[model samples]
Target chain A: MAPKYKLTYFPIMGLAEPIRFILSYGKIEFEDNRFESDKWPSIKESMPFGQVPVLEIDGKKICQTIAICRYLAKQVGLAGDNDWENLQIDMAADTVTDIRTKIVSPNYETDEEKKQKKKAEVINETLPFLLPRLDNLVKQNGGYLANGKLSWADLYFVALIDLLKFMIGFDITKDYSNLSALKNKVLEIPAIKEWVAKRPKTER
Target chain B: MAPKYKLTYFPIMGLAEPIRFILSYGKIEFEDNRFESDKWPSIKESMPFGQVPVLEIDGKKICQTIAICRYLAKQVGLAGDNDWENLQIDMAADTVTDIRTKIVSPNYETDEEKKQKKKAEVINETLPFLLPRLDNLVKQNGGYLANGKLSWADLYFVALIDLLKFMIGFDITKDYSNLSALKNKVLEIPAIKEWVAKRPKTER
Candidate 1:
């Protein structure tokens, strides 16, 4: 018999980190299948959507990061106990993704001038407009991203914050007390702490 | 008592159309609170995440379009029957959103040269890269976006296709038979047909 779960992703965390965090938090065993970048082309056609971060469950493949995180979340008890709460958690998680998307593309720009200009806009405009709102949301939600309790959304945030800080070139949580505390609270989890210390160190 | 659900959004069917489609499909009653664009600044302060398409349930508000759509999808009997099914549905739905996100921003570009360049790339590269895969998925899934059934993801795609067509300046389904069938199948639903026929018309 095979493992109950198999995660197919690049060696670095990137989009797959939340799913990894959730799996780690649950202490569930899995085959973490990380392959080299050059191997992607040969593998792309096998993917359901030609995307990395595909999670295989019981030999059936599922694509999309949040979709995989959400499916595993229910199994790990990180999901909400009810529909409304789940809605809140999903909403908060998607908002965090929205903020991340706004800043991530700049790193991929080939033009140096375009990349720096985009970085300036991110540092000056995008981060200022978005982070304060997220910070206040954490303040209102009692340091969790939703329902005033620990959920997978916080895990998702902590996992992505590394990639985000690398992209934006600073600790995104530095200016906001609530966000900083939220980051601390998530990292304090023994599972996450252990994983963070041991997971591959990537510049991304 | 207040309505069981109240959707706050702009008058146009941009982010909020799928939620509206789900609501109408379910025959669920709610206040369709469409407001003027100028009023957004005032209303923005009260919104969760300062975003529209907020679905209020029993006086509490939830933000994020897909989150609201998923919540209402369950109520409308359009959600997946199991966790695996839901995962498949969500993956497909998010893929639809991923494509939408890729092509939406160019329409808002202030510079005509950049806007046209982005449009050319979308028409030349993005559409060619993405739409056919989706076309094949619909074919493989039996005219549905996921789970080989008519889930709300199908409805979500149908609601979005019109806007995507407008943005791309052509009928996106023109070259893809399965995708064309999926669009027609979704539109032919009595509730959605009625909604589309009667809903406020907009350029977007």
Candidate 2:
């Protein structure tokens, strides 16, 4: 029997989307539990760390999106077979995460000057730094982040690039041909395409 | 033959310590490469995303410390064998990462007022949020972050608390009894103790 999994989030793709996509791609049946903003205070108390994107396995609740995604990746055999490959996948995903946290996570800055400054820094400093590196790695690894096969890291990169486009109103791969090609390839995966097509129509 | 792994970082253990610790604990041989201040620019150029703590595996370099640690954890059999356990471990490690990024990362602010304000928020908002939750989980899981065994998450937590002490000159775990106890237990691990005792000294 498939183990019961319940993912609790704020109806936003912010953190929970990757896990949701992974589970959907894997065809795993689980609950996409979203809570209203007003209900967050009460919900937050029940959460392990007062944060959402918690995955309830059987009855045990798990916190953190990467953990949940990685767990699901393992369950669905999306992670590579050996430790080295698994670590490579993790490293790729985490690189995307680093860029997100540093450049995108400060969305709460309402000041125009600060926001623009940050955006510029991201484009001028962060994007240039990461795009070329990813391109080189993709080329070297035969176009995959790990094991020369599609892994969670590849999907994560797609999601990350998609996120940057969504948030920044620009395509990161515009400058990096390999990344652009990789993103397109990942999006074309039958499971991923199907998941995206049928994904809940909501914005975080 | 064992694959060669090269880790490049500043002399301090700010971010790369956990990766180094895991590799050491696993008895995995890798180059503990450090950078002179003068060499940062050239070294930084080689890093994916222009960051430190890059891990070169079999001549392929990977970035992101959490990703590297997770990879090493898998190699050492420190991460759980199954999806559920791995997710739990990931969550624990990520939670610690969140606190570090949100609260501790801002501590580098040069502005004295802003620094103090961020530190206060960390003490008042972040610590309260994380410490109790971690304590509860530790108690619930019989003192381990996952699988009732020493995990990468446990080591991460230990490292986090140690970093907080280093940053603020105050022992955060002292208030959270469970956290303090857990830290002590992690410190007692023979490998960790030996590593700490023999770790190259730096004043960052």
Candidate 3:
């Protein structure tokens, strides 16, 4: 029997979108459960680790967004065929995550001036330092993030790029031709395209 | 022929110790290359992502400390037996990483006052809220991190707790009995015992 899958997350494309994209790409059926911010406090205690992007498989709950994405990616055959390849994909995914953290860190700052300063640092210093490396990697790896083929890292990056742009008020791939091309390639996947078109719009 | 393993990191166990522990646990021979801080700038360019805790297998380099640890754990027979089990372990490892991040973030603050404030919050509110949940997990999982037996998450948490205590100035496991027990169990492993007794000490 097919396993029953249900995902609970806030109604945002922040962390859960990659899991949603992977499941959709695999044509797997899952409950796309999204809750509002106001409803979260009451429901938070029921979540594992009091966090969302909790995936329920066969009625057992698993927390951690990346872990869930990795699991679903493996189940859907999007993971690497071997441990070495998985490591490469994991490295790429972590690189994308590192960039995301840099952009998102200042958003938590209560001081408006400091937040603006950090945002400038992210835009001017960090992005220039980080994105080119990623762009070069994609170019060298034949347009995929790792192992010269499509993997969950590709999906994860594209989904997060949308949020990054929304958060930082800039198109992240404007200067990186390779990342732009990679994002287009991922979005061209029929299932991904369908999901992107139909999924709820998020502000970041 | 056995694949050659080489780990490169700073002379600190902040993030790389779990990889070292896994390699030791597996009895795998690898080059344990540690460098002083002053030498990093000159050597940073050659690294995959300009980060430490890189594992060079054969000749190829893999970056991201957690990714390296995950790969080494698998090689050492410490990973989960199957995909779902791997997911469970990954979730636990990520949870530990989250807690570590909450503690480490303040250590980088340039403003001394803010750093102390953040550290206070981490100890007063965060630890109290987080550690009990982890304590219950350890208890519920039959004294190990995941799947009721030793896994990478157990090693990861145990290795990080030392750094956590050194950073926050508290033995985190003091109130969490199961966590303290888990630490004892991990430390009792003969290979880990050998590694920890001789590993270089760092001030968090």
**TM-score for chain B of each model, two decimals:** 0.95, 0.92, 0.96
For candidate 3 chain A, the 10 contiguous residues with the lowest summed lDDT are: A42-51
The lDDT values for all models are 0.87, 0.78, 0.89
Quote the lDDT for A167 in model 3.
86
Model 3 residue B102 lDDT score: 89
Interface RMSD of each: 1.1, 1.5, 0.9
Which pairs of residues collide in model 1?
none
Candidate 1 lDDT, tens digit per residue, A150-203?
999999988898788877888888999988898898898998888889888887
True contacts kept of each: 0.75, 0.98, 0.77
TM-score of each: 0.94, 0.91, 0.97
In model 2, what is the error at residue B189, expressed in angstroms?
A: 2.2
Candidate 1 per-residue lDDT, tens place, B14-46, comes to 889999999999888888899999999999889
Superposed model 1: Cα runs more than 4 Å off: A1-3, A108-111, B1-3, B108-111
Each prediction's DockQ against the real complex: 0.77, 0.77, 0.82
TM-score for model 3? 0.97
- The predicted structure with the larger TM-score, 2 or 3, is 3
Q: List pairs with backbone clashes in candidate 3.
A: none
Model 3 Cα lDDT, one tens digit per residue, B72-183: 8887889999997898899999999999988888876667898899889898888888889999999999998798999999999998887888888888998889999999
lDDT of 2 by residue, A1-204 (tens): 778989998866667778877887798998989888999999999988888878898978888877777878877778888877777788778877766676574464545776787778777877777778878878877888767888887776676565666777777778777778888888898888888897776643
Show where candidate 3 strays beyond 4 Å.
Answer: none
